[model samples]
Target: MSPALRRHAPLVLVALLVLYPLLPFLDWAVTAIFGVRLQLDRQIINVMIFAILALALNLQVGYAGLLQLGIAAFFAIGAYTTGILTVDKYPFQLGFAGALLCAPVVAGLFGLLLGAPTIRLRGDYLAIVTLGFGEMTRVVILNLENITDGPRGLNPIPEPVLPDWLRDGLDRFLPADRIDLAAIHWIVLAALVGLLILMKNLERSRAGRALVALREDELVSGCMGIDPARTKLTAFAGGAAIAGLAGALYATNLRTTAEPNTYDFSYSIMVLCCLIIGGLGSLRGVVLGALVLLSFDNLVSPLLTRALQEQLGHDSTSVFANFANWRWLIFGGALILMMRFRPGGLWPARKREVDPATKADA
Candidate 1:
């Protein structure tokens, strides 16, 4: 990369992401020539939503070295919280915005609950505890038939609405039909951008250093006057809060709370895999990982399967019809390759340099 391009790479990326939702409106000649309309707004939104979740996981695993195996539990908490508070089936009806605001706080509280008692555990023990909590959360949601609708899921979970003035202003520039999708895309993208900034700031803060120190050597950091318990709890709760935020936005886009199984253990594993693929602890890496993984799952797999079925003149039951089902195999192969070669990550954290004088003193 040229020095100038490298210097402004992040800005260029953000600009591209910001302009992506408007691609369909650009009237590009190639689209008409190919007869292939690129309706990728939903895919972009989904990718960003997962990016938020992956970044949350990054905070716990990358920043603080906390092995969280049950992040989907918190995700479920956020989605269900939004559903219960906003859906007309119940009396809460706090509205979409209110529910969105509250979901993260509620998930964070649950984070504190789980972390308070288990903060003393380390490594594998902590991982086991988290995995159990995740499954337990899914089971609890499953059994709560009345509140969550159990296996049926919650529907008509209303979409967010902008104020009349804002809607009117937007209508002047965008088609009424496309406004809602575009608005949702903008909202989620803005949230992702905001969180990215917040996380960047956090990584430079005193607490960030403490988390890193604790991650390096807990006992040694404690000797330096860091409170390991507090730091771990903070990372845990903070990560949960971000996951909750992602869940709320996800539900809004899907227009449902989805089934309890939606937040299953595999969901957590998927986010973990995102971190692993992107290189843990790098913010840009999280976004890239999410984009790659989610785009393949939501876009490429479905499109490829459809194209193959059409070309082969095959029905859904035909042998060549289910390309999407191979996602796990592909992911597993990719992970094995990543571990074998780029074990540090696709974008590993830059190592800190110690001054020669300080190294000599040590």
Candidate 2:
């Protein structure tokens, strides 16, 4: 690398690390330039949660080449686990920290339970089985009104409590209104950074290679003595654990948990879209995909809604102003165009080659 490139590499990485959480600060410039008031902080936090979810999905679809279509099930599992554990409800009152520790474990156990039976299946069958598992989970949550509160879900879940030292310092720096939001943002951002580092390390490990091999050719991998069943089950369980962690964070941040309806197929599809658009088997690609899709879903669509109302010269409630529903149509079309033009994704992973000299002569 050139001297300039080398010097700037660390800075670039640092900027990217900060970009997701700091996106809301950009609204200041937008407000100054375009006279638009935007809630960048809330949107960015939401995106961070989605980004973590995408990372988990990437582990399944990207690394293992598993077409898991029911990730939202794991997400819901985590959310409800956190809610039930942390909320001071009729029968439980575990702390947020305890919920954080236990939720992923429960979720991973569920993943193992689900994967054990289905990992032997391949392709579409595996996908269908997993999807059915996810839907079945939702139905159970929906019907368990006595415990889960059913469609009403759980409420008054406690906000994640911060250490006194940190809380005191934050209170000194920020006004009351900004303190809670800023704390949550920083905490979530920290969790995301931690997950990124962990996943990146996993991608470089021997186990990761086994996953890649399984993705490339399960039969050949099995012939080489790798247990495809064990590897796939591990990936499924690990990915589900990550999803569960994300769900816990989300519930604690929102201080509430919705019914199964809130975590339906649409959310699962969105997470899958993030992995597909980002690039299979690449962490950087997954993050990029999440940001792009989330930016469209949360930021661009809202702006377009306002723009359409202005162009129609009518109130937003008018039939001509029904631009919100069109957002998904446009998004779906864009996905098709992206797949058609760049099937490998915008930032596809570069294939690494094994040195010929290192290979045994056949």
Candidate 3:
């Protein structure tokens, strides 16, 4: 292939891969042969959402070297912000657009609050504080009965309102069980693509360099004129904002309750595991991480359950049917293996040379 073709091949492949599940033919073929139906539409939606969280997480964990074990705190903040705004639990209803606008801001503010005092600490200390923040956020949500309904959580969180014609075109015309409001998924995928571009740019920008410097050696970077605390805090806020945006989208897409249980410590650990298994400092790795975990959780595991049922008939236990429940155990093993064998991750980040032209411009 020509150099230009080589350059575009990955893009072409990714485009096909993203669109494949949306097409029915592949699903039909797989079901016909494997006797397991794949919920590709829901899987794709989830992959895109978690991919955003994983990417956001990379900012703090990979680039900034902050051990944030409480990312779900910000995620909860974002989700609850959207939930309270749009639901009837509050006197005011902000709707989907408002949720999108407000969720990230609230999450980022919380991030700022959490970072202001905690960024100075490092290693296990920082991790512990962040973990506390995560649990604390959940507790606060559980206690705030007036606005959040406490343990009941917020239900029927509204989805994005799109053009009526578009909705008709998708739901009315597409094959049954294909996907409703598929335009929503397309919009989200577009947003993810845009965010991915911005993140890639950020990785190449001066702020990215400052973050990397701090990650490498805080004391050395501080002596050379970098403000360690400020840089770390900035990264924390940015990551939180991204998580908040994702949280808003998540609540919207779920169209269900954004309960406190949903944003627990395990969720934070899961995203962290995704980042680690995918490869630190590798953008592609974040995508890979989401794909691996979500695909197993949503796609393969369910298929395994169906296959088990067919093999053993109705008497088969729910345990075999819901192997996805064991995802944490699977994730734990994957983390241990990754750390021991491929510490960099399944798709390790490659070091890029500094562009002199960009450096001089800086």
Candidate 4:
């Protein structure tokens, strides 16, 4: 392939992949070709949503070398922010767009506040602190009964206000069935594309270079005139903002209570795993990571459990029947295997390289 084709190939492939779900008879094709009812509609939407969270995480651990364990706190903050603003019991009733607009900003503000104090810490210290923040956020939400309805969480979060035409377009090919997420799915796909473009550009921007430099050596980066402190702060806040957006979307889609327990430390770790397994610092890696890991947990686990039960003699008390219950054990094993055999990831991000031709042009 030409250099240009090599460069653009990933983008082209992603575009096609994103569009495949919308095609007529795509579901039929999957069932016919693989004899597997691959219900991709919701699954693809889920992956795209989590992909945003994974991409957010890439900014910290992947690019800036910061160990963050509080990503879910920001996610919770975003979800709760929407809940407080949009739920009918609340006075604001900001609606979906308002919540969407404010979710990331609120999360970013929290990130800013979080980083201002802890940005100086590194490695495990930082991780512990962020982990504490995550737990604390959940605990606080659990206790805030008046504001958040405590453990029950806020409910009835509004959906996005899409145009009738867009909804109509989404229904053109599919049966007028369930929630009809076609429009929402398309919007989220657009957001993912926009985020990917933004992140790729950021990877090549001056700020991105400074972040990479800091990752390599904070002292050296500071000596070279890059403000390490500010860069770290930016990384934290920016990453949190992206995660918050994902959370807001999640809450809106569920249209149910945003339970405090749901945004616990485990959720943060799962998202972290998604980024790591996909290969840190790689946007495409995040997409793959979210799809692979989440699909395993959401889609494949059930099938595997049922198959095992049928083969091993169906018994709810039998270990085979509890296969789906081994979610974390499976994830933990996957993490270990990935770390051992493919530490860089299944689709690891390429190491940065300077092209003499491009440098000379610049």
Local distance difference test, per candidate? 0.86, 0.82, 0.83, 0.83
- Candidate 4 residues lying further than 4 Å off, grouped into runs, are 1-24, 28-39, 165-180, 354-362
Q: After superposition, how far is residue 274 of candidate 1 from its true place, in Å?
A: 0.3
* Model 3 stretches with alpha carbons more than 4 Å out: 1-6, 17-30, 164-180, 305-322, 353-362
lDDT of model 3 at position 9: 76
lDDT of 4 by residue, 1-362 (tens): 99999999977977876676557467777668755676766677778888888888889888998989878898888888888889999899988889889999999999999889899986789999999999999999899798889978889887776577865776666555432465566667877888999999998999998998999898899999998888989999999999889888778767754678988888988988887788988877888999898788766887787677777774657654767778888788878998889988878888867798998999
Q: How many backbone clashes can be found in candidate 2?
A: 0
Q: Give the top-scoring candidate (lDDT).
A: 1
Q: Estimate, for each residue in 56-150, the C-alpha lDDT of model 3 and write its tens digit.
A: 89999999989889999888888888888888667668888888889989999989988998889857899999999899888988888877888
Candidate 1 displacement at residue 53 in angstroms: 0.4
* lDDT, residue 286, model 2: 83
Better of 2 and 3 by TM-score: 2
lDDT of 1 by residue, 78-167 (tens): 998898888889899988789889999999999999999997897889999999999999999999897789998787788877678878
